[model samples]
Target: MEANDLRSYISSHKNIFVLRNKQFRDSKLVIDGCNLYHTLYFTSGLDQAQGGEYGDFETVVRNFFKNLKECRIKPYVVLDGGDGGEDGDDGEFRNLKKKGEITIRKAHALSTGRLRNVLPILVKTVFVQILRKLEVPFVQCVAKAQWETAALANEWNCPVLSNKADFYIYDMKGGLLPLWSFQWNILSLLNQSGEKFVRAKEYFVERLRPRRRRLLPVFATIASNDDIHLDKGSLPNWAKPSKGSTATKDIDALFKWLSKFKKQKQAINGVLSHITDPAYSDKVHNVLTQGLEDYQLYLSSIAEFFTSGTALPDSSPCLPEWTLQQLAKGKLDTVVMDVLAKQRTVLSFPVENSLYSSSNRTSQPIRQTIYALLLGVTDGAYVEEYDREELEITSSRVEAVLPSKVVPNLQLETLKDVKYGALGSVLSYWPLGTQHATSCHLVGLGYKRIPNNLKLSYSMVAKAKQQFFRPRQRLALKHVSHYSFSTMFRPCQKCFASDFWVLYC
Candidate 1:
């Protein structure tokens, strides 16, 4: 039975939730097998395309297993055994088949392309093959997959991964949506067991404590089967009026009243008491009382089904102990460290002299501007007229001394009219620590460019001072009295030595 509108109810109260990615590490995840099949069909885009064969299914399932392996997760897959006598007689199965056919016809009308008829038996067969190939342990339940999965999760103390919203009603420790668009959340039980399951910085629910009494389970079973939608108002009569009134309202009012009590037993008792009262007519009272008894019997039968070994089959496949051991090891740390190493390599500045080639000289002004921006220096002349001239003279001298191929085509004139309107355009190319040095030559050139009467704004002056002094500040702290000439060509280090030279001369 579907727990309608339950997910929406839980979402409205979000303080009780935590993400799955933050907590699922090294945890056993129980997957609903049929749910996975349906999720794959839609999410893999197989549903949208024409002429898709069942062979494409293995690739999607393989990728899913690969992701689980990457995350260091141990998964237990459970598939449903057909019908499982949930339907009272043959008529129910016939009715269900008729409904399925109707649904198929409607789907065909709505679909634009040729839709493959994905039967349960066909999908299950493919799934068994893939599971065996991957060496993943799985089970096929004798009855409904939902209850079996829920019972197994409760027994194993793991979370259930399924698209079914009704898992919330089943009181699973967690419900995970493993779709592409799924967010991380552990829909935990409110009591102490839930507290132990959540990770640091994750949240837990205090309000949704599960009721343990037998009668409350009956209430849950009735609520599950009944088509009556629950809202704020559908509560019992005793919970309605403030301590005195005997008046009764509809199911909506009854639900609202019952919600006030922390325990479901109290609410169920209130409901029972209200319906059994002498104020009601004998015919109505007898019918209501009999319905409650029937509900109790139905609840008992369900309990019997769960306790019976036949209902929940032990269908878990045997796998090698070494394979199971491999699944348990956490690999996220290694993956994360590798990612960090790559990032460090990318962030490290190119220190080689060959990078100073004339072809790269044209990129200097933009690089200098980005460095200046990182240092919070905005008003400074990023490429001073003198610096340009000095570069040109140096390039000419080098060209006369060395072979033509050795001299780079330095384009100092290109930076003459460049303005620093926004550094975002070029910031991506700049290296880490590019902003630490103070280019006093650029700052002095900037000072010279400003008109005497028209003073630069405080923000502009501050940015310029910060850009110019930050590098010197860093160098002074390091006890480095002089900057090397080789490092001088780089913007961050260039500022340091140029500033020192300007100070000494």
Candidate 2:
């Protein structure tokens, strides 16, 4: 996720504190549905396409999942489409599967980027349909677009796990910034030792650097309530399929629907035949011909091009059915507004206990603010305002108050522990603010300083007499400010003073 999205997700969620008295519940685990499916599909397809044979798709998926299980993580998986029920027997999509002629290979081929420009809609649809058959309960978020995903995450009070930084940008209330997301995994980064893992992950985290932005409000502004224009062909590749025995049956149904325009055009042609209006007749014939060509091209690609028995139409275009007005909120929720108010406040040393607590029924503004505070602490200092007017007050301007003299020693120890690694050592050898100490630091790695410059060059020319000629190196120049090298080597050669140059040693 981009830094912006991380900040948004963190700020829009409740803070998760290390429980002082009890262990956190396991129920908080939220798995990303789309992300997981994408992982399985892409990995399997790429692996297979590269000619590395794998077992069936189910086996590949199962093995992929087995790795996650070995890590002792049980993430709750959510999906955007209807569920396919258990044993692949029946669910919301069972009837459709029974009525459709879709095969895995044909589906995969039809879903290729040559058609959709590399989009994953077809893959998502396939998984959703399969999951529904397997009885996995997933939901299409009631709100359209990313907000639906964000809203679900908010309702569940869990991290919104997704590979896309865009998810973080959408202001999902109660969305936790997901760490250890699969996107970070790479072969070289994997290590046998725990220490190496820690170092590598720290390095990786440093690089992500989510952009600082108020992303939730921005996401809320763009989400659609209804459909828009099709960047792809009609009939989204992601739509659930109706099941039937023969692929031909599915294609026949699609062809019949497409042929409707043909019938209308023919009727218009028949009516125009009796009229003397040549211009109107010509216009009607042109529209019919164009529509026919488009429909035929779509069909020909599938029915004629591949030379296979599969029956599904190659593709179609679709548009969302809703209007903008339906998707837009009339007024921002008071709770969401309150969360933003807290972001403008001052940071507390020990995050308030109120920030850590979340009830399912309660609005998650407090939690979101706390999470945002935690994220801010990691990136920089947390500055908040209790009132709008106080926002401009800098930390220096705010008066510091002394703590109570009677505060418990244990509490002090706990606070110290929490902030321990937060302020990592400025240097291994010396602390900051020490005079001469900072100057002692070398420009590069610690080493003895050398005050000379050195240069080396080589000269060569082609020789036709000898089958092969060799090039030789010569010292070109030397000057130095300060630098060091562990070791240096050169071919042995004799040096003589100008007066003794006649005598070589």
TM-scores of the models, in the order given: 0.41, 0.26
Error of 2 at 57 (Å): 3.4
Model 1 is weakest, by summed lDDT over 10 consecutive residues, at 343-352
Q: lDDT of each model, Cα atoms only?
A: 0.37, 0.27
Model 1 lDDT per residue over 1-505, tens place: 2233333333333333333344445577777877887777555554322212246667788877776665566777876543323222233234334434443443343333444443321344456557867977665543345666766665666667775644544544444433333322223332564432222222222124443222333333334333222333333343442222222122223434545666644654554454433554343334334434433311211223223422322222321222122111210111111111111000111111221322223334333432332222334322211112211212111111111221123222222122222222332322232443333222222222111111233344446546555654333212111111112223232122112111110
How many backbone clashes can be found in candidate 1? 17
Clash tally, candidates in order: 17, 54
How far off is residue 201 in model 2, in Å? 8.1
Model 1 sits at a Cα RMSD from the real structure of 28.1
TM-score: model 2 vs. ground truth: 0.26
Q: After superposition, how far is residue 151 of candidate 2 from its true place, in Å?
A: 2.4
The segments of candidate 1 whose C-alpha lies over 4 angstroms from its true place after superposition are 1-4, 7-23, 48-52, 86-102, 111-121, 171-223, 227-255, 272-505
